[model samples]
Target: MSHDSPLQDLDLAAGFLEPPPRRDTYAGWQRWRAGRGHFAPAPRLTLGQWRALSPRERSLYDLHRTATHVNLPLQETPMSLKVSRLVNRRIRNNALKTRPSTRAGVMVTGWGYQGKTETVCEVAAAFEDAWLAMHHHLHPQPTPGTRDVHAPVAYAQTPVTAKPKSTCQAILGFFGAETKRLTLPELIRQLAASLDDHGTKALILDDITRLRMHRADDQDTLDLIRAFMSMNVTLILVGVDILGSGLLRQGHFDEHTRQWVLPPSQHARVHGLEATQTERRFDLVELDRFRYTTPGQITAFHDHLAGLEANLRLLKAPPGMLTGGRMPEYLMRRTDGVVGLLERLIEDGCQEAMDSGKETLDEDLLDDVVLSLDDPERDALAGEVPAIPGSSRTRTTAAPRPACARGRGRNTVFDDHGPRGQAHG
Candidate 1:
């Protein structure tokens, strides 16, 4: 019988198609090879050779070698989940003791850029998690008249173009009730029935500022708030200082409502842990700008950055490319203690290095990167080099030269260069 084809041979002697490049020289070759498979000695290429690649070729090479795309899970463990739970717990506790005629209310106010939105997000997460826990049988049966009305509600449960009803009817629908056209009193009765069924007692309204800002005098909105309060429901109203200002100045709510201002003392207490401590006792909350790097955290972050720069210098980076242990200092100076600016600086520097094919960044690169990072208004002001337009140049050509410089052709006389130029004008 004929032997099996060599391509399909079984237990046949192996033969090499080509020898691999030596390991020591592979790295240099790999850099030059750009995108064609692993580097091979037969197809040696220089840095110039790689540089000469067409844009498309280079892109393909990058894709084949260094480029990778990942569809990161869009869903992250929501950062606000914990804070939401705490707020929800307070709400539920108040709701349990509240009656249809009496309720406890709290107003939360802070300046803009403070973590008001984040706080609201956290509260929402807590509510969601609480519902999930109960559904999964991890929590005991919810107490009657204290259950969350919104937990069981689905977005698709309502029909399109349905007329708005009483707040109690809305709440009932939230609890998966199909009854429609509920009167105000009937709605309240249903709400009580549902809460009793689910054992939920608390309610939270994030950003009462919306109502205050848009429709402070809208009877329906006012009635809704009043109704909840009358039911003795523990209500937490989150808002910016504007909301508090609005309430105090404009009188949105009646005098019976209590206002608990979050002073600096509360802020300090919440964020006042040692730098190295884990599991912060108080939620470290602030306006968005002040969140990532607190004033207290800045020094430590700078210290770490300095150490990193020093280590890089110790590794003997090229002159001009070397940070000279000044990168951190430069960043600190440029940022002026703004954490957001510092983050953008780092991002811009890294991106510039990648674009320029430079293994190390220089001071000039940092300056350019920082300048590029400036906001439009800042950039406009920062540009000292005047732009000479073509039309301006044409106009200058049409205009007669200064009398003193007429014989000197187009040479500028008042150059401000020295005494000779200065004296001529």
Candidate 2:
């Protein structure tokens, strides 16, 4: 059999010809021949390694690995200098004082959206550890009376019918003695007792208005107030402006309560002046809407903005800069001098920007956030105006015309005196 030329051969062979190598295989062969290093996939990180990463590094890793990078939200939001300093001073003073008294507490009151709740929560968290420490130090042991009651009874050197025992049992615990499960009143009493036992000199009740409102009975609230007052515990009662008005109306509180109404200026003065021989105390530091700012304040705000920007950059954000230099001006106008408003605006603005995948915050975004705020004053204004269309016109008009007289050619209306003569009066 004469085989066809190799180029023209066409055999119907059942066995398949050797398959050509894949492109990757050839590339691998070439790489191997060239003695070039092979590209190995990056090593995977274990959970422990991931956990050990710093926040900044983690943020960068997330950005590099994913198209959508979610920022790690801030835990402790920034607060107004005024609010911060006031809270700090109050907490420090109360913590350091020798006895608990009503005057030692802090009272914060402002309109809604002014960060009243946030302020309270922040203050609580800031001092909670210290409060726990103080609580422990004060109630180290049960009272002698309670201990004596626990002694076993004896009858003629022998147990006789197990001497009918009293039903009441004194409960002892780490905190103190409790006759029964503690209610609010019992808890307050126990806390007071513990403080008294430990020489705690200060007490802080954030939104005392809530307590007042919940305990509507004037006498009951008054009694509680008196208990705090009698203890001479420096008390701080924080609430909205309505709190001041409510306290004024309450029969229990009078000029004495007003004495604790620390003005913003006093707050500023105290913050400005360190403890001097004559002053020797922390004054109320008022955060001024207009004045009372230092270069440090601006620096602090800018630093915070810079940190935020750095986080944004890790997400591969296009070069963006925060122009918060005008933040003070923007805050002043938007908040209308309310410290709480300023803080909320800043916090909300950041959240809004992050939500929208924005790397930079502009004035428009801030204005939108602030202007959308609910205005309580608007509600009050609506209440003052009547709904009738012509009511305002009627109110603007002078007293209705008295009996009018018809003149020869013109109709005339009367003044307060009576009907007035027309053309020939």
Score every model by TM-score.
0.37, 0.40
**lDDT by residue (tens digit), candidate 1, 146-191:** 5343332111111111222433444454455756755644555565
Model 1 weakest 10-residue run by lDDT: 416-425
Off by over 4 Å in 2: 1-104, 113-191, 194-202, 210-219, 242-244, 248-258, 261-320, 324-358, 363-425
In candidate 2, what are the lDDT values of residues 1-425, reduced to their tens digit? 12332211212221112232221122322222232122121123443544466665444333332221122223232444466567667656654656422343445554434455444434444454455465562433336554221111000110111111111011112223463664544555554455456443344333333332322353244334434434434444443343333443423222543333321222212223212212111222222222215665555545554554544422223333443455544444454434344445555665566556553356666655633434432222211111211112233663777876765653223101211112110
Error of 1 at 400 (Å): 31
Candidate 2 least-lDDT 10 residues = 151-160
Q: Candidate 2's error at 354, in angstroms? A: 5.6
lDDT of 1: 0.37
> Alpha carbon lDDT of residue 392, candidate 2?
22
Best by TM-score: 2
Tell me how far candidate 1 lies from the true structure as C-alpha RMSD in angstroms: 20.1
